[model samples]
Target: MASNPPAPEAPYAPVQPPTDTFGYGGYRTDEGPWEEWNPTAESIRPVRGKHRVAKQRGGGFARSSTVLGVGVIAAVSAGGMASANTGKAPVSISMPDLPGVGSLISDDKPAPEAASALASFGSEAAVAVDADADADQSVADAGEALRSRIMAQAESQKTQVEVKAAAAAAKAKADAVVKAEKEAEAKAAAAKKKAAEEAAAKVEAARLAELAKQYTLPTSSYTITSTFGQAGSLWSSGYHTGLDFAAPTGTLIKAVHSGTVTEAGWAGAYGYRTILTLDDGTELWFCHQSSISVSVGQKVATGDVIGRVGATGNVTGAHLHLEVHANGNAEGIDPAAWLRSKGLNP
Candidate 1:
């Protein structure tokens, strides 16, 4: 038999880099030179200067999604490899150390150096996202607190205004009540004073009405030519001591009140005189009369004719000279005043 053909290689087998320990190697294949690469802290660090990564347009969402998808794919590949080798003897598989090739491997500690850097980048991105969310929540909470404070202040102001208005209204009502009470009191006082004055006037009127029934005038249709207390040479006294009523000759004179005739006769200078003594002992002298109509000691009623007017005692004209002596006193009082006391005008 012909010698067995050389074992066929898998089409997608990983290419191994040349075993060189220094600088760059010039290993070539159909795709390109399989350059050797070794990961380091400096090589894995993010590029700066002119070779720096450009900033993403929208946000970090695309970067985060890419990182998450890579992690998921690595985890799934690791799980599949573990399952496939569950009952097989351990075998050593070699892979080339090439530029950018470490990122595609799935292992327990996948791409050791590069994985650590990617994890650091993912952690920083997560931290940045968390910090932004926290900032947004803080601002929203502060705004809500501010709105609450404003509402509380508004309510407080409204309450104060209502309280003040209520107080003002109460004060106004109280003032009105006090003013009304004062006005009522004033009206009551005025009414009381008016009633008292009217009552006093009524009593005075009643007293005068009663006096009118108990007395009578001495004569009528006569003119008072002279008044009591008149001063002239026509009287024997310094002043007129009686009232003078001048009338036509022979006019009748009447008794002023019910009384007894104490004297009824002509005396010197008294052409015809009559003296009436009342029950109270007051004497009424009617002098210078034309004639006496009653005798001495005769009882006469009020309004009874007692004498006639004539130009008699110290005569000047036809008139009656009437004098009043209270309580039998010889000195006479004003006849006109005494007549008024008994409810007569004159």
Candidate 2:
């Protein structure tokens, strides 16, 4: 111990390791009479190694959900492609039930075994992709069937509507045609009725003109002194039943129409009266005449001289009293209305 020189005194302090660029944990350096103590295994716990939480490319659960969504999209896209390529109808494709990848992630513990399970799921996903084409064909078939049914229903409805519209149009057209026909018939009937009336009027006018040519006035330069049905004491019956035409005593009288002389010369009260009988059994009496020009049974034409006007028996002045009896009726009708029936104004 004397051979070695004494060393410098050192302060009592904890030992510290040398500094280095490489970071290292410190080591223990103690020299003392200390006994090594081993704590109870139950009291002390084993320290676990420090570990880092590995984040997925996105969040773990979110990335898992994204993968599942991508798979579904791929399946649908494959179905569309199958429908386009194959002429055959497609059948429905049911997706296989899959375990959830998000449930495998944990906040506290790392899941190394879950990664292996995920690798197995990846294999299963590959199998699903391989079978996707067939599944797409089935789904396309089902869609095609549904579309065909809907199209058929629509086409049927359209056809029904068209038929109804056409029927209605036809009915309306028929009704219009019938109405037009009826209207035309009615118009034609009206026109025919008007034409017949015009023709009848024209025929009547011609007949009247011919009758006027045949008929003649009883006397010229004479005036109507009295009409039929006059009440007076001068008449023997107390009522005049004849038309009286006044004139000078020698005025000439003529036959009104073609007729036969039934009686001529003096009839006591009528005074040189002439009786003319027409073809229709109408008797015309010219009373108070000065002279008679026609004999009994003599056929006289219309306008032939029959008598002369004079004041004779049963007369107040120079006048011709004319009476008419038709159809053996002794009582005479009004001469004015009777003359109008033959188209005469007198």
Candidate 3:
């Protein structure tokens, strides 16, 4: 605590830690925090602890930097190797659920469960489409059958129309035939009526002509002395064959009727007789003629000078013997009755 003593002196005066060079030849200083001790090159000197600081700043700092660089290089190499091997980091996606996720990515990716379900639906759609196509075909077949039946009906109708037309034509032909037959029958009836009328007219005209052929005696002084069929001894053939007209001589026997004298000749058994043939097949005899003015085959008009009458043969007295015969037959009908039927009486 209190005893102080004098210390031993260094041999060379312990070099004063080099005097701090001052002035122009010493340290440099300023108002900054660190000051320079030396100002000139002459006063420059080394510091005492410089070596130690240099050592620490040199090798020790270099060693530590190298270590750090090596560590960085290793880290880069590891990163490059990991990139080359794996290509990229694994990615994760967010989705709703497995139940509905396939419906969202239908354009691109397909999940396993989703792909199986799609295949099943495709097969079912194909079957449904096939069934629809078959149904359509059946419908088409039914329509075709109906159309064929309609066409058949049309053909049958056309056939029926043709039959009706044919029947109408046949009926028209029959009607024409019947009409023609009726016309022909009517014409025949008309012709029959006309012919009957003509025939009746002709017969009536002939009757009138016959009536004109007969004439009556002017005087009712004559009688029939002999008949055509009177059988007696006076007749040459045991029959009174000729008609007789007994009248007084010079009885005006003007004319029997208006007729030409076809014959004016003598007849045997009628001496001095004159015969007059009329236009008809009738012979008129005027027997016992006093004279005859007409000759045979002479055409004489009625009331002409044909002859005069006289009893010249087989007469009881001078009486006119008149006889009438038809077609030169000696046996003749009653002249009076025949003349009455012709509208004349004698």
Show the colliding residue pairs in model 1. 269-313
CA shift at 146, candidate 2, in angstroms?
20
lDDT of each: 0.74, 0.73, 0.58
- lDDT string for model 2 (207-247, tens) is 87788888766888878889999999988899989998899
What stretches of model 1 exceed 4 Å from their correct place? 1-194
TM-scores, in order shown?
Answer: 0.45, 0.45, 0.35
Clashing pairs in 2: 90-137, 90-141, 91-137, 91-138, 91-139, 92-138
Give me the runs in candidate 3 sitting further than 4 Å from their true place. 1-220, 303-305
Model 1, position 91: C-alpha lDDT score: 33
lDDT of 3 by residue, 87-138 (tens): 5442222333444233423444556765554444446555656767877899
Candidate 2 all-Cα RMSD: 18.4
